[model samples]
Target: MTFVVGPVSVRTPASSANLGPGFDALGLALSLHDDLTAEVLESKGDERLEITVTGEGAEDVPRSGDHLVVRAMNATFDLLGERPAGLRLTCVNAIPHGRGLGSSAAAIVGGIVLARALVDGGADRLDDRAAFQLAVDLEGHPDNVAAAMFGGLTIAWIDGAAAEMQRLETTVETTVFVPPEAVSTERARGLLPETVPHRDAALNAGRAALLIAALTVAPEHLISATEDRIHQSYRAGAMPESYKLLRQLRVEGIPTIISGAGPTVLSFARGIAERAPQGWAVHELAVDVEGALVR
Candidate 1:
């Protein structure tokens, strides 16, 4: 197989998973994005790979082959049974890392899509479904990857070991309050119990279903639909300020939830940047209709 000449670019949207009680099932693609461009290089000396990253997390991310995006690209090339002699990659990012914004998922999905686009006739070789499966497998979860790959609102699940998802359109708007500090997903997850009361589980189930209706059709139900009894409160200590903001917003009749694992709070209602805590960055974002676009 021949590598495509010149560079291919991928624009991938950021995602917020577990909109409240959906747990590991619901996700929404946001307007924030990461732009990645890559091209095959002429083989010279031992420089097989070159990488540069700017914007969010650039100073902290790895510059070597083990970088998340490069690793993901390598995985895709392995699947295609071909390798470019030399490669160069550049990432311009707007999504903040470790901020419950699905940054890692975006990197993985973007890399896979970018790689597929760089190979001649690659769309015919590895279709979107196959790419999504590979992304889910690499991320170890389907929620964020589903939304990042397909866009809009996504409900993702596992069938045996395979990842499956349904995408839906929504007109809901959101404002995210991102804290100054980062919250590790692992640390937040470590605070959860092995199980929960049956009643809470039942409550989460019904609300998760209602959340679909609220997001897609009835915006009036957002406050009730976003109620959660599963994870947020249990992990509140990890991000007290975020949880406090969530409670404050809910009391004001504003629909709100902790974005993903925590430290970033998202409100369904807009015009609320003033409500953000001091030292936090806020962005009023719309739902991204197109998940990842190749150009």
Candidate 2:
């Protein structure tokens, strides 16, 4: 019998986390997506795993088990305590790697979804929450994973074995300004002081709370919502141009914030408007209501 297995496709949206003040707590999903295709084949004993990636960072990303997607699958299989059948994976990555686009989180979630579908009777056993847990555990963060899994603006907190998520309203059209440079999450985190002053911590807490409220209750508060007493200022040296551009946006009557850790910045505006820098390519995007899924 010929087992005609599919190149199962999974789509996960690009996300911007932390916003500015909501450190490790808030995230917003963008319209750009990472598309993955995985297929199961009766492989020869010699070829246990094979993967091919195309688009965006195809030239830069690994095409073997060392890839983050493959790592996510391996981690999932380990959790299930079963040696899964090998897979031939193909990824069409649209989101840029190390550009604050949550590309790694998307890859991790995409791999988990693909792995579940490829295994015998595994797809039926996997739930959204379960898949999300796997991605979060593998990615070591829940903000981006939650947005990739649940969609919209997501607020998540990790609690030992379980993760709690709250989906927020994404009412404005989001425009991203991606600088040419790529900033690693570790490097961004390293820029933060070991311990923020008590007053600064308190300020961030208040701003974070107000940001969440503004997302739900008052859209006008978004201007203030983008304020940060936590990460953005400290990492200004990494992407000084972004900081300068943000100030320019404020002067130009645009609401902008650092998308995630650094580098990529995002702005939310209504109507048909364009306030991006001349060299930047502005993609008119919206909130991706649907997260990672097979089609």
Candidate 3:
């Protein structure tokens, strides 16, 4: 297939995963976004990918084929059995990297959406399921990718090689306290025990179910709904400050959890300013209704 479209732009929202008890099953999309623009260049006989990045991680992110966004676009082209002639990509990113806020997922979704828009001639050819699967294939999980693609609250699960997701409505206000330092997802996962006790697993299962209901229907149960025994406690040693902050917030009767793999903490409480500790940047972000958008 010949590349026929002009310039295509895509915006994808940042995401938080786990939400305490759900552990790779639940995710929420935030208002923070990363914007990407892709234009098919008139072939100059140079096939090298060109990427210009501004905002977060601009100094470190790749400008070549190794870039995550470029890889995603290439994956889309491979999926369609067509090779991109040549392209120029511009990225304006706002989501912070490695703070448990789905920056990588946003990049992958943004690139896929950009490619889909260009290929479909401004139409959104990448539906929710297709986007979820493609992103999962790249990201190795569904939670963050699902939220970035579908927006709002997403319940994601993998079945064999396929991924599934359902979006849920949420009216709860949220506040995230991001520390200056970052803890890589790999480092945090390394802190978790290989096996959890059966009782803890059962307790977390109940809370996870309640959390879904509280976010969608029973908002009053949020305080109890956010309790977890799965990943958070096991990973507390990785980010002791974040863990301590979470404990303090819960003691004050607020529903809080380590946002994804953490170093950043998320609170379901609205008045978080008074509760937030020193040396943390607090952001009040709403649920992003439109996930990855092609414009």
Candidate 4:
């Protein structure tokens, strides 16, 4: 795998994982995206990596090889047994950071797909399954990465030593309510209990299955399907506002769930118009059918 072209561009969509009962198993890609461009530097054998980021977390994100996108790209090159001379990377980000919108997953997928394009000299060589496994290997989880790689609604799980994903079709439109505050995925995960009652575990299993049915065939069961007993209430202290908003929305008969780790709420309300509470931003996003694209 070698590249005659100097630059390659890739775009990846934002994703929401752990939809209600699924908990590290389910995710969906949204219409929001981030664009990244990778170019091989002219200086030969320099081995330097330069990254320029604009929009979103530009002020705080790294501008070197330590950047998530650059790391992913490097991982791809390592896997392909090819070394480029140097790299210049530019990122145009639109997804909000720490909002449970899979910003990191998008960056990882974008970089990997960028490498796939560059390795083939601007031609695509990575297939869907290969991309899913590579992203999962880098991310250590399949939920967010699966949606970002395959698009639509994805159910991802570990099969022995390998990761597997299946995409499902959903007709419901999604609305995400993002609060101004950010919730760290690490902190939110730390709040979960090490063990739960057997009954609660059984209930979650049932709900997860029903959630899939609600998303695919029976739309009316969505409310009951979104019921969860595993992680949400346990992490209430970290996102009181999101928990309160979720309760209020459910009371009003809206099928809403905490997006990914929380601090962002996702509602499958289709065309319904509902008012957002004060101090929250609302975005109406469709399910992205296409995951990542190269140009």
CA lDDT, every model vs. true structure: 0.94, 0.79, 0.88, 0.87
Comparing 1 and 3 by TM-score, which wins? 1
**Which candidate comes out best when scored by TM-score?**
1
- Tell me the tens digit of each residue's lDDT in model 3 across 1-295: 5566588888899999999899999999999999999988756686757789999889889889999999998898787667677888999999989899999999998888787776754234556567668889999989999999889999999888899989999977899999888899999999888899999999999999999999999988998999998799888888999999999999988899999999899999776676667877788999998999877
lDDT of 2 by residue, 26-117 (tens): 98888899888877666566446777778888888777778998888777766656644567778888887888889988988888877776
lDDT rank order: 1, 3, 4, 2
Look at candidate 1 and tell me the lDDT of residue 91.
97
What lDDT score goes with residue 142 in model 2? 93
lDDT of 4 at 119: 79
Pairs with backbone N, CA or C atoms under 3 Å apart (clashes), candidate 4? none
Query: Which structure is stronger by lDDT: 1 or 3?
Result: 1
Which parts of model 4 have CA positions greater than 4 angstroms off? 45-48, 121-126, 270-274
Model 3 clash pairs are none
Q: Candidate 3, overall lDDT?
A: 0.88
Residue-level lDDT of model 1, residues 8-115, one tens digit each, is 999999999999999999999999999999998855564578899999999999998889999999999999988777899999999999899999999999999999
Lowest lDDT 10-mer window, candidate 4? 120-129
